[model samples]
Target: MGKILGIGLWVCIVTLGAVYGSIYLATAPAGPSEEDAKKAALELIRGEPITIPVIGGGDVTGYFLTRISFMMDKEKVKGQTLPTTELMTDQLFTLLVGNKMVDIGNVSSFDVNDFREKIKTEMNARLGEGMVDQVLIEQLDYVSKEAARKSADGGSRPMETTTVVEGEKLDEQPASSGH
Candidate 1:
């Protein structure tokens, strides 16, 4: 009888402990939840390379070769195709050719920040408010008519490729001769 009583006591104690543990856990405050810790998921969409002609003195002086990328809101773009190519090409032409944003002689005059903002703003305005998160420039380069002719004529002068990032200028690197 005593042994049976002790067994029952042990079972009761374990049952009470389990109940207390469950109650404590259930009543405890939750830590940072997934929703609270989560950030808006953004998707990166890379646009096709654009070539805009720089016309001056009634002639095509040089060509601006640019590749633009965009960061879009994942939720907003779900089940939808963005008209990025058409919009980007049009805006880039307006900025580069129409506005003369880039100076062929003074490449340092290019403002990448303003360029990015305008693109982002215009894209968001066209698509929808808060649809675009950011505008990224993958490539922004200028090839002069002289340089093109020189390379065509087999001149060995290295074709320089300029890399611009977030309004900071990187050193110009020599472009490979071959396509």
Candidate 2:
């Protein structure tokens, strides 16, 4: 009985050790070194242009008002300037509009973060390196009479107030007069 118990204890110890070992290995950080990180940052920023389609439209031209660049550090950009610029051009906006426009109303509803992630993925693929950490939108605006009108009018114009309902239930009526 003692022998059996001893063997069982050993087996349990072995199993526990194996489990902990695997867990430690799996959760270990595999982040690149500073040098490799910098290299990746540079490579991502030096790749070809990537265009992403926008959604919704009227007879409007969309423009990226802010700088179309990703920062690795304060000094380094994630991708090359030309490609990044091209990615943020009116043409890219048009392509997005063409591909994604479900209705005119859907244009303003965009997930900025998702778009940035998409750009990052594309850039990484093109560069064959994971360098870009994020893409940021400096400014985004649409050039069109309608777009201007929408903005000026406070988004499709202020909705008119039809009526004001004061307190008191409409179900109860005042005492009726009987002659």
Top model number, TM-score: 1
Off by over 4 Å in 2: 1-66, 73-97, 101-108, 145-179
Q: What is the C-alpha lDDT profile of model 2 across 1-179, one tens digit per residue?
A: 99999999999999999999999988957777887776554322222133333324453443222223443332323334444434434433543444542223454456666666765676556543544565544334333444545666788664322111111222222221111
- Please give each candidate's TM-score: 0.60, 0.35
Q: Relative to the true structure, how large is the alpha-carbon lDDT of every model?
A: 0.68, 0.44
lDDT of 2 at 151: 64
Overall local distance difference test of candidate 1: 0.68
Best by lDDT: 1
Tell me the deviation in Å of residue 60 in model 2: 6.3
Model 1 alpha-carbon miss at residue 168, Å:
10
